[model samples]
Target: MSTTADQIAPAHDEHHAPRGLLRWLTTTNHKEIGTLYLVFSLTMFFVGGTMALIIRAELFQPGLQIVEPYFFNQMTTMHALVMIFGAVMPAFVGLANWLIPMMIGAPDMALPRMNNWSFWIMPFAFTLLLSTLFMDGGGPAGGWTLYPPLSLQTGAAFPFVILAIHMMGVSSVMGAINVIATILNLRAPGMTLMRMPLFVWTWLITAYLLIAVMPVLAGAVTMLLTDKYFGTSFFNAAGGGDPVMFQHIFWFFGHPEVYIMILPAFGIVSQIIPTFARKPLFGYASMVYATASIAFLSFIVWGHHMFTVGMPLAGELFFMYATMLIAVPTGVKVFNWMATMWRGSMTFETPMLFAVAFVVLFTIGGFSGLMLAIAPADFQYQDTYFVVAHFHYVLVPGAVFSIMAATYYWLPKWTGHMYDEKLGRLHFWCSAIGVNVLFFPQHFLGLAGMPRRIPDYALQFAGFNMISSIGAFLFGLSQLIFLWVVIKCIRGGEPAPAKPWEGAHGLEWTLPSPAPLHTFQTPPQIDPSEAHG
Candidate 1:
């Protein structure tokens, strides 16, 4: 067989290694590191999912039935921490590690050893985090936001939690640096910034966001640790420190952290929608601009989350307007997706199904966010189930569904095997239906005055809460189907062609299925016409 220019030439290869577990432990190969990230993210997904299930099960009947209230709080807190830091962020990084070099025709990530270090650091951090469940005072129950006063009360687990968060931040910063360097320095000849894939473009922006915000988070947590142990007054009320100041610092990082999780999803959806729709992505340049706009807007909109913090009228108005401005760029993205699908020869592949669901559902989340952005309206919605519903919609279906879509869209390329189509569709329906069942009713609960982070709810809010729990369980269990599909594809299946999706475009498709361990060792010729816009 004649090897394509995009594929690594086996005949002249000197980097080949004998297979063993040690290869994974010490390997600097980008593909191996990327695989490690992905597998680790999957494991954390299940671990976090278990915590979520515990939370839902306890909430299933309104009163404290399954776990103690303190333990329940731990479950809620740990679930958010695990999912955000351990599952979602790492999963996106995994995708970036695997796909960025492939899409850009680079040989590997710019710093291959750092890529392995970034992936390896996560397991130890999570192990320390999970170990807290069995600690003296239970895990940090003040919630994942780790607001100072309550966070200081977390007993032995407080320092451990802080250390875990610091570890995660370090890993994230290292990963971000690697991504920024890779995208900026490693593109093949003729691959200008404008010609990069949306996924690549989004990751470039996301890496910058990560580098910017992860350190802010680290600083915030470090201050908390000091206030607790080192007796610093950063957030100490007795020492003349204002707790609200902590809110200001945390949300500054928190809001951008939200974008960090979703922007890559935007990139993934941008990639998948065009492929199954049999069209080039509509307004490709606009998509890139919109992503950057959203990132810029993210930094300014942090105050919206703190609308109830009693800022002056001027401050409130400024935040409200800034928050509303985000909708414009976000609307551009939504319209572009719709335009991409407008009258194109669309097919309802599993990936397309997830991508379309992402547009509709993420928009729903965005609308609710806009509603919350109104400083006046937020007074009513603050700390309620409605607030919970808003983010879950965005994260679960929004960020996570996009991940599933990308997996389906690219798994063939990654594994050289065709996944079961019927099974894939079944997983989609379950996730779509189950997620709605899970989070949609939380809106009703929040509006009806049910507070979040409490183990028990009032008798009045029973019905919708029950419905939400049922949805949560269904949504939680349905993920097992996804796990099965991934494993089955990896082990064996019908062989996949290099271009598994007929409409797919990119240098990635130019390489053979289950892309060789090394690709683009000699930079592939970058033809402008062949690149996805």
Candidate 2:
């Protein structure tokens, strides 16, 4: 049967006739890489969340219930590694892969083959990590921070840990480079920086951060490795290399790492809030300035994480003030969102529910972060369950929630089918309530002096631990609702329209459900994607 322009694609898939696993394995298409990144990320999410469950289960009764302290530490370390690199970062990169080209009016990523390589390497990197469990000594237990001294003594897996970190960093750098090239060099003529989507703008900034810092991470971990094996002391205290010097280097990369995680969420909220509220984004200029300011501030304030590390009062004061400055730009973003929704029609689709929640909850995370930034108070709060609670709130609600919201908001566009609205709401409510229950009590535990990263906690921490564990299980199980909704939509659902959401904007929305393989092959308008049918 010869195919013709009038012929419908098999199974009505967006990527027609990508037969067998080869389609996935050898693929260079932006959408396919995006799908790979997303599916890989979702898989890691469960895996990481399961590690969290085990941690909570151990803490359920105050005594270790599941594993030895060493193994438990490994669990926490790998949980963070998998979540940050294997899960959240990949999720946003996946978003960039799928949406960036369309949003910016580029035909595809600047380097398509490199995109596939970048995504494919992640699975292998994590494989090396998980394999460490069976190694002679076990995995890195220095936490995902991978701080030295403790990192020095790990067995067979320690080197693998360094290598895996390097691999992940390499993959990220490649992805970022491609993004930078695409956004800067490939946008349609007259698509000035201001008119580009905030998502694009944020990603452009984020990709630059990745390029700059992944190398720092690379250098730090490389130094750690050589110090362990080759007898170098880039971070070795004995060789007049201060261990705290390594902290400065690691966190210099680490703090911007935080902004890297949340910046895309900012872009996403910018897109979602406007559609549901039927309003233009308020303070767009301020939003961009605020985001850039935060990124700039992020570079200088890496020292706040080291408040307890015994820096001089001068250093402490400088870092504290630098960290506090971040609150201003963050506040600008928060206020902009509120003003966007201040006087407009708003709908509570699954996406909007999550976006609105992200604003409230991420702000809470930011406040907690600001408090932590205060050096003196941190002497009390450092290493407590309070810090644990704060980040999980930021991460789970902030990053993961944004990913889920994006899935729901764009599922129709991707699959040409509407997700079950009822199931979507159920997923939202269950996950939301369950998440709060899981994390909130830890705040009290932290305030009460429960130190973090210990395999077990003191007996007095028992009551709250039990409640948190129950919430953990519930929250873990609630995600299945999301999985089900996505699966059901992909397999079969009611047809979707070109512009499924009434107030949707941008080029992606202009395409029919199940976006085509090649779109806007020739730029049409001054800002090509803004070109209407």
Report lDDT (CA) for all predictions: 0.91, 0.87
> Model 1: per-residue lDDT, tens digit, 1-533?
12222333334343565458877887666777888888898899999999999988888886789889999899999999999999999999999999999999898888777777888899999999999999998889999998878888898999999999999999999999889988888899889999999999999999999999999999999999888888799999899998889899999999999999999999999999999899999999999999999999999988898888789999999999999999999999999999999999999999999999999999999999999999999999999999999999999999999999999998999999999999999999999999999999999999998999999989888888789889988888899999999999999999999998998889999999999888888889988887863
Q: What is the Cα-based lDDT of residue 40 in candidate 1?
A: 90
Candidate 1 has its poorest 10 consecutive residues by lDDT at 1-10
- Candidate number of the best TM-score: 1
lDDT of each residue in 1-533, candidate 2, tens digit only:
12211122122344564778988997777887899999999999999988988888888897767899998999999999999999999999999999988776777777877888899899999999889988988888889988888788888899899899999999999999989987887786667788888888889889989998999999999999998999888778788777888889999999999899999999898888988998878888888889899888889999899999888999999999999999998899989889989988998999999999999988888888888988999999999999998998889889899899999998898888999999999999998899898999989999999999997778898899899989999899999999999999999999999888897777778677888776656653554434211
Q: Cα deviation in Å at residue 72, candidate 1?
A: 0.4
**Total colliding residue pairs, candidate 1:** 1
- Residue 5 of model 2 has an lDDT of 12
